[model samples]
Target: MRARLRAPRGLVPSLPAFAWLCAFFLVPAGMVAVFSLGESAYFGTSPVDLSAPSLDRYGEAASETFRIVFVNTLQIAVVGTVLCVLLAVPMAYLITTRLTGFWKYAAIAAVVIPYWMPFLLRTYSWRILLGDHGPLAEGLGVTGGFGIVDTLSGAQLGVVYNYLPLAVLPIAVALDRLDPALRQAGRDLGASSWRVFWQVTLPAARPGIVGAALLVFIPLMGDYVTPAVLGGVQASVVGSLVSSSFLESQDWALGAAAAVLLILLVLAVLAAAALALALGRLVLRAVRPLDLAARLRPRTGTARPARVSGDAWGLLLRGYGVLMVLFLWAPILTILVYSFNDGRTLPVWGGASTRWYAAIPDNAVLMQSIGVSLRVAALSTLVAIVVGTLAGTALARAGRPIRWSLLGLLLVVFVTPEIVTSIGLLLMYVAAGPALSDGTLRLVIAHAVISTAIVAFVVQARLSSLDPRLSDAAADLGATPAGAFRRVILPLAAPAVLAAAVLASTASLDDVVASSMLGNVGTTTLPVYIYSTLRNGMRGDAAAASVLMMLGTALAVVVLAWVMQRRGQGKSFAAGLVGR
Candidate 1:
């Protein structure tokens, strides 16, 4: 007798996503790896040589000039990551613990909603704010002596500003899951409030803190945009070096080698972190007996409260939070105000007028770029939602090994630097001949590669929080697998999926490096347009373009919120979004 069996649902649905990734993401990456081995083509016009490859490019990449660039990049990324962690941890703790009700929700929304604005616009806004004639420089009477723009300090400021959300969200999630009873227990046992925090709280949040650090550190190491826009040539990092190698020098091999080296450096950092954790676990095991004894004898029956009163601390923290909010928005506010300035110069705000905004409609190039950006964003978001949701579902339901493999691939995409991927995608497009020279399809493919990972991560987070028993119950009732998914699981996952789609769209819209490298004439997106305007000394026009870009992406975020609210998951989704 033949046995009756039902095929698995998730893996089957997951095939399309897997294939898409292999074709678009993995192929481009593999091509780059292959390119790293070959000799440089003359002006990058001749066909690539596929002969026996050597480590010639690697040796060149390790030259003294490049070594200094690597060290500088490391120092900046480390400093920026440390600053972000210090700022984010305390702020996230305060929001989770001290704030309540409406204030708590409002606080998170304030931090999150600003991020919906394209990062390119935010960086551009910073450029104007920190320029020699800009507010900060003039106000401090250091217009020429010392300022952020075109300097390493300025680049670090941009890094911290851009990646702050990444550091905060993970730590916030960890804090949300933290049990208040643990802290209370420490206090009742005669430990000071600081001691309770040091012993009971920070350790519990270590994983999230580490994750946040990785998130900030990885991107900072490979960042080209912040340095390009704010730091200028003097503050060039490894990312700028890679771009110069490929585009300016037209040395494909050297650029590929530099990209590979950057990836290795990131991997090294991850390995060091893993080793440190292992060593920490061993040390903890060795000191376990001493720790237990110390705990047993520590009771003084004289528990001291925190140094500052709770109300005073809350007030201070709340004030600091407001200041941070202002700091984050200051550049954006500057851009918005200056967009309507009735003058040619950017830094000197002329009398308020809407001439710049009016000029936008008349600029054919600007309008065309806007149209291209919208279509690309829309198409990329659609692809990301479908592929990412399927991949996320498969990972959630698949066997342990399969799940882990999928997770590794997703993380690889997440942590890989944008410049590296941008160059890689550029090379792949170049290799595809005249048929693939058009930028639109290549741009969408490049964006979908990264955006899909983001969507999958969001969906996976939602799925992890759900109970498998709900699906099992449906199966127990004789409902078909597809029927159960459509009737039960889909409703639950819809809010997160929609939110992910919005995020994906925003990411696609905000992209700079990938689109810039892959794009040719007549294919410019808004970010590419803004970059060109800046390069060509059209700051006023860039500001106007930026405002429009911000409005579009911000609208998507508003829609995301509405979707969550309509699905009756508003509060829960907000918590998840804030990394609770």
Candidate 2:
């Protein structure tokens, strides 16, 4: 008898994610690349015409104006990333080493709270705070306020605040994972506290630092919200340029070319970072022996006075931690307080009242947008969880080639600027014509594509830590592969799966880039609605809506934390939230 054909071990399970990404991500991105080579059709039904393709758009993308915008974008990203690292390192170090029990989790929750809130809302809060008559201005005693609003300084501050949590969480996880014995060993060998931290602790946390940098820089490069809301015309970056090229100018070819350049810039930065890291490693290896000898040598002289006592140092760290917490929550609290404003506009306070909260029910358009956001988030999250779980589980058990290949693809998906993804999906939908006309469906697909990589990473990290024998044991008991997976693997991975679900949902709900590009009048997500409102001028009702969204997100975060704690996985929850 002929032997029945058999599928590869991990291929079947990984197919769902692979197929979805190829169709939604790869195909759309390819379309964008094709559009970049074509010319814009000014009066044609389509924005681009590929009848005679050339490299003209790319040359235009490299012109003087674009060069200035690109330089500004890089400067903001580099500076913001450095600030995030500077702030996050000490805070994360203190949290891991000093805080305990309730305070530790509370501190972490503080960071996660702002991160969980909608991105557009967070940026818009800064807009309110920096307004001429806003609280910061009033408190600083600047008559018409410090001229931060609609300027580069305002944009830079927003960038640092918005991406700070992304930098903190990963570093915190890395510092938390460090072995305390390594630091103790250094101290016992005549090394000072500072030396121990520099030689032992910091080097060990390199992965986290690198992770945080990538997390901050990649998205910051694509962030138009902060620049648009805070910087306005003077600080237009490459991201805003790409956005306007399509949305306002109707120049799809130029937009696509600019997006391609943006991606190249990101990749070049990453490549340079990798090279620097490699060179640093080589230098470290060369000097490692001398460093070891110095550490091993006995001290001949009397020790100098301690620079600061342990108590003083601890107090300083605690004080810094308090400041960090305040910085994270300031914008959110501002929104909550101003949501009760009796005034028509958000910037000026006109006494405390609940009219905006009361008016929420009467605001039909806002309510409809809220409903759309909820529906799209729910549906996209469901799809992401299913596809990501299957893909992640298979990845944990797959062969080396398949695992690496898929991981690389997922990393690209994760690191690709959101604006690029939005443009690609928009272009794809436009190419598909009327067949994909449902706005909500487009939003769901776009959101799912973004969230799936995150879910898959989280799930894979969770599953990789489990023993391989669990499923094997189940199989030995005469269970089928499917039965073994359901009975043993699924239950074991539940916490991670649940955590991934929460992340995926929150990401979808908080999304602005894809929602704005893919949504229409009837399908406007709450973030897109708030963005438009803020662009026109912030209203009290929008502030109220932001508060409600923040509370909803906080509730979800609390529930997830409680459930994970019940499972004795509390320590890993934050890392899981960030897919570390």
Candidate 3:
């Protein structure tokens, strides 16, 4: 009787969103998959001609030039992911162990605030910093072949700096969730501090570490802006290669083939991870007998006093924490300082001035793009809030089949590289011709497609943590289902929903790859505008726009942090985005 009463609710509220995704997101993605098999067709042709498809495009993508790009993508992504993980693990440990109260939040803020700046601006700042006369090269006396700019090393550095939050937040979540009792148990068993960490804490944190690696690696493979501006023509990665094929070479078939290949590569990585997890489970099962026997046996060693070296190790970790914070923010701080430079060239201090800030309103193209981005972000966030909140609420009470299906859809959206999705959507839009090719509409749809999954994740986390009994109690009273949702669930989940909206708005504004591929003459977002400005040597103007965008982003993030803190979730919302 009790089990029957406890059955899940909210399934009915979810169907509208499920249908919306099927039409916009799923159908568009299916079109991409179908397009992958065919030759590039002339515009206004039938959408999918199943009559004759060929493998020639795939063969073309495997050519010698592309082979090198593929290798570089793998090398750079792996190295970048490794570097981010190694750097983040220690800093996460420091935050979880050493810091407390207000200082704890401050340390996390230091790490996350750099992300408030658009990614393109952040990567371009690296371009300024690595120039011949810049602080880094001049201070270190680097020159000739030893220079970082225009090299793969520079691209790798940019990737690590940009993606570090992906690693830190997840690992911080894992460490935050550690069972204190288990740590005490290890010490009570006479294990040293190092042994306790190795056996208890590190093992518990492995999931977050693996998640962090996947999050960093998947996007880094398709990174365009970093390699484009920082690595220049010399350093070719998969994203640059694919961009050239479509935008520069106009070989749609070859670009689609390459994108399809990249998607497969990401899928293969996920498959390997799944296989490894299964093998781990098997090994754990095989070792359970020995573990049980050992536990049953008595221990003879006396518990020693807690190790005195913990403070020393903590101090060392705290130093690394400070260094990591600086590494993440140095380029951004440089950009902020350079925005005020009166000189035409970057990194040269010509008396302090707000001339660039004053010039922003005069750049009509830049101002137009800002207007487009604001509208897109506003529309995207509104759509995401409605659809994602419904889906999130539905998933909370959904039975196993529905839950797994929605979860799989979310994973598909999450792990698919942005470039692959961008190209796919581009192909889909082109096939539909003039009637459906409205750039503003396409940009909004693309932003919503990407933003919905993230918003759903944030809302889902909050919904899962809600007390079902309150809604039930309201139902027992005079409240209708709609009324109960409004009075109980809605009020409880409002902060997370607000936070999700803020995040969605920021993501839409900051997007570059999709904006680059899908934006037409009428629709260029801030990131796309900044990319072009940098390419054309408009440093001061680009800096002006970036400063304005960062100010807006900073406002959004402050709201996000405040709401998340009010919910007592801390930075868990940031972790959830990647962990999902």
Candidate 4:
């Protein structure tokens, strides 16, 4: 008889996450694809009618209106991503190189705090700051203020501010991990600081830079909140268009088609970028020898290169860092100050009072929404942690083929626009009929789909740095695989697990896209509530609720930072947040 073949040790452990993604992610996405080829139902309970499938939906998606919005969305994403890279590189450099100990952690906290705060709250804060009669306009002494409130420029600014930290964290982690000796060696070779940075540091940090760009660009492409809140209808993008198609127009076929188009657009942009990069590399390679020859040519005079003063460079970077921190904190601080407004409207401040803050407990809907958000975030975080930890550990021990395959799937989850995910989940839940009728459950499941990928990346980053032999040693000591994981690997991964849990919870709390799509009347999350209120002219009480949410988010960031620090894995922990 042939010997029985056994599965790989890591394969079984990772099956839960794999299965979860297939059920919740792939199936829903497939359903969306199928729905895109169908027509809208005018009479049936279902939004989409699959009886007759055609590519007509795609044709409609390619109409003049969609083409304009698609172009605008791509422009915003490209420009915002470039700006994020420009700002994040120096900010990250300052945090990793200039700051030390307390200040270093303080700087990180500055970025993470605003990042962890509710996404709607942050964008809404900008509505107050850049509004007519706002502080900035008043300070500038403009007649009718800046008039940026309902413009593309306002949306662009908000997108950059909201996603800047996503860019910063990954770059900081990359710079922090760089070997100091490389810089020292460059100095020993008489290379100027500028030359050393350009030649060595920048190249070494390329992966982080690329990661940061994608981190900002992917989400920016699908962001509807910023454009909706700041730009209003005037600055509509593909994301808002898709959303309106589904929620307002009840045109499921058009929405599904738009979502598919958005994904395709993103992939096309990435491909174009890759091709451009490849062509640039070829051009650079062809010219490199000539450039090298020019450099190696004998000098006729004894003149040396003019060196920039290190003090000047340091002072400039420090100033830039200060400005960047102010940029990150400005909107949040604006929210806190406006939360004390005694007036009814959020933007207009009548007087400083704690009335809004005090009235939070009295708002029945707000209180209930907070409760729903907490419950959903808590339950989703729990599910993500369990599934993610297993998948993460498995990836650390799995074969290269298995690891790459899983990683690729997670990357898809990361890069696929959130609006696409939201629409897919919405379609999937609708298709499930009454079986998944519970709105809160739908919210939890959708949030968990995104969070699971985040946690897995964090845990995998932690485990990758550990000794694989530890598990082997446990096995050699007569321990079962389960016992070894419980006794050994679990303890070692506890910090990352906890850090990831906090991060995932904050993500779920801050989510606007998925929550808005998946949530209903009785199951609304706090972010969704705030979003609705903002749409109908935000009130003082809403600002108060935002302040409270920010405080909670800050506490969570503190805990996450402390946990990562305790294990001396602060750098990787930060990078893992963006799945680097």
Candidate 5:
């Protein structure tokens, strides 16, 4: 049967995506890993490093600041993961297993829509909505009291709000796949709902939760916006530390070391999570007893389901969900509203005018930054989508060796922190010895490595549902292997490939950490420029910048969503796009 099975076509369905990943992921990651071991000079600005094997930077990471930031990064990651999981699980449960009918799809769509928005917009919106004197405080009538506008709480909110959907969707999918009958069986055997949940639900959902935690934790550890805006100086996470080191303080060695430590920390956490889960499962299996066909079956009685009456608790959940949604959106709203401001209070609607927006075309650096960012994002996205798609398709069609090599390459980027990734890219660029000194090319290469990893996973998921039969049927009708692929596979997978391309583009567009470190002076991205504008006190120009970036991202999301909806197979893929 296996031998008789016709071969599938060009893998073109995933070709663009696969090619994007390949160009971006494997090549860039390889470049970065090489650089991490190399040396960086003049704060990350000079050039790359082409040196012999060494651990000097890794050893230098032993400083107190590195230790503090490392610990803090881990703390943020752990706490953020826990918080997102707690909130996401309940929300996902209620939305998925619990609720049905009209609100179900709408609820999922609500979460979906915001995720598609630009992430920087999402971060900035929180700052606006959560500001101490803003409507969030006033609405709750906090009463001349405080708010989390600039506190760690605000940072936490930023992390959770941006990532909640990321955490929720994966777990919801896992929980949705659970056998409902498992719960019923436990109930029929006299187990309480809570007991059944603890035994049946949590266990099955564990992998998904672990996946969610890994997804959230890894990114949180490397994130810069949440900390920069919400955290301010009150407990700067590792990402902020790395950015400061390279961009502000010129502490390249320390930054490199810290980046290296972060990579190690990520590995340790992954191992620990895996090991802990394994042990937990083992312990649960050993101790957990079967219902054992309880001695006397209870008289059958219709089970009264736990009801959510949509009262205060329901209202609270709905309100929190809405607030979270607004938190994700309101900054863009504020930015939009304030782009018209004459340069006054941000959260409030000061006088309106288009002066700021009009004046933007005159601000050369800002415009230059915009140009540089778009160029970088565009190239990076192209590279990522192509490389990512390539890896995905190859993995599907490849032999074991090819698959392993491809995955191993993706993992390098997946595990490497942005700080480390940047430092590595710079050092390696220098090490390449002036041949690849063009900053734009370096940025593209750097982005490809990291983004290709994500593209691969997404493309792979899309490929799972693909019907090989389509390709096989084409091939049997005299179509060549390549022709079959071009005719059948490419068209079917076009939606996923396109979606991945947009995703990679947007992520490249918003990134600051790596861009700050590796982007040459003239090539700073939008986030870098906005950070610069913030020093002038988040003014109208800055607001305008925020608005511009927000609109750009929002436009991308809309296009992507439209593309996804047209495909009709985009529900899952759309949900996965909450954050980069």
Candidate 6:
């Protein structure tokens, strides 16, 4: 206790995250819920009083247009998710159990580096690469085999391409924690290797797989970017439906209604998750003989004792890894190499130019947007760490009821779409009037609330993995709550906190739909800037800007990883892998 007191007062380490949630996350989301019930405004900061809380908006949810987009969103999300699972399982397997040393590091890096490229740029890159305007047609020796980029299929491919990493990471973590001995026992019991994987490893990793699936699918359901540019109207998803309601038709109420439906759908997904978890527990208890989860714990503390060597499947795995990496990064790479492109098309490799990169300075509006994004991400990261750490610690130490509520609230925020978040923030701002309606503060607050919940989820996941005895040991040694936390919990949980902060920052940085809707005139962020550039057909400069954001993410993450390591947090990086 005395040591903690002496450490630093700045690290009070006891911010009331619940209060933070009420003020930011809950209030804003509640405000949006109200708006979803009421009518939307015309141009100013007021909800239209044309109607007072009605089912009219929700009625719109049942419309045929709604049905089509909803079905489309589901179809795309399901297909994309399936592809992501197939691609990621092998990729994760290779990274965790097969690859060794530099190859391991390289594989991990490869999986992650594509994110440094601006998402818009990556989307655009796929456009050019797969388009008849690009090289895929010529290179693949197929006249129209490459035309897939212009259809709904292209959008699905892009969504899967972009979100593959998100899906892979969680699955890999689950795979990392699997007991190799369980599989060995299966082999000894005369089970085939494939049977062992299906009956043993797959079931063990289901929660993570389910979580990852939901994580990918929900946002992708509300995803605006890929479908907007790639699919046009041919394969438009619900995201496009929601977006067009606002920008194209200027129908905020309709958009808010759609956003509300999306939010409900997300909640339903969480409920389904809970039901599954409960059923699994019940199934576990039903028969001690049916305790499948119990049997899958890994005996090997270490993953992949050796690096993967050669064979067709190994090559196939490596090729898939490369293909996925290329699929994601080739756009950024094309842009990087082609931002120097004197011509819009590539592969001929002739006149190189940095004209676009040089022109970035001239794009004052775009540059300002970048500044806005950085500031938003930085503020969100700060708020997220404080709230996430506190909430996480509280969940670990608090009552079960409180823990479940906190988790439920966090899940609600996590599953909610950005458009819904934006609408919610707008309603809050409208209700609050000029106090919050017309400043960068509102955008920051909106981002912080949602991002913080995500960070808290990460923090809670990490904290739950801790041995409770560690905190108990500190307390038994006469450490006060704060002191014990500082000495024991904080150091151990620091890496998770840092990771949460980074992810929050990335969410903030990458967010365009929310920032654009909530931001004021001339309020710009990197994503908004990239979006504007893409909208303007400034593909080259857009690529340059995208590369910058991607580079920034890479630099920030690398530096964060390095700093965390310096604090002896290297091993604890694995702390939050298991959702327990």
The top-ranked prediction according to lDDT is: 2
Off by over 4 Å in 1: 4-9, 43-47, 140-145, 288-306, 536-538
Each candidate: what lDDT? 0.79, 0.87, 0.77, 0.85, 0.68, 0.71
What TM-score does candidate 6 get on C-alpha atoms? 0.85
Q: Is candidate 2 or candidate 4 better by lDDT?
A: 2
Position 189, candidate 5: lDDT: 80
Candidate 1 lDDT over residue span 318-426, tens digit each: 8888887897788778888888888777667678988888788888988999888988888888989888987887777766766777788788888899888888788
Better of 5 and 6 by TM-score: 6
**Per-residue lDDT value at 89 in model 3:** 89
lDDT of 6 by residue, 232-332 (tens): 67777666666667667766677777877877776776678689889987986676455544444334554623423347546777777777777666677
**Candidates' TM-scores?**
0.93, 0.96, 0.90, 0.94, 0.82, 0.85
Residues 1-580, model 2: lDDT tens digits:
9998867666767889889999999999989899999999999788899999999999999998688899889989999999999999999998899999889978987887788887877788886777777888888876776788788888899999999999998898899899888777776786777777887789878999999999999999999888888888777898888888988998989999999999999999999999999999999888775564375444678674466666888999999999999988888888888888888687788999999989988999999999999999999999999999988988897777778878888998988999999999999998898878899999999999999988898989888988988888998999977898789888878878888998899889999889988887799988888888876787778678878887977887788788788878765665577665
- Put the candidates in lDDT order, highest first: 2, 4, 1, 3, 6, 5
Badly placed stretches (over 4 Å) of model 3 are 1-9, 42-51, 141-146, 284-308, 347-349, 559-580
By the TM-score metric, which is better: model 1 or model 5?
A: 1
- Worst lDDT 10-window in candidate 6: 5-14
Best by TM-score: 2
> Model 5: how far is 465 from its true place, Å?
1.7
Ranking by TM-score: 2, 4, 1, 3, 6, 5
The 10-residue segment with the lowest total lDDT in model 2: 289-298
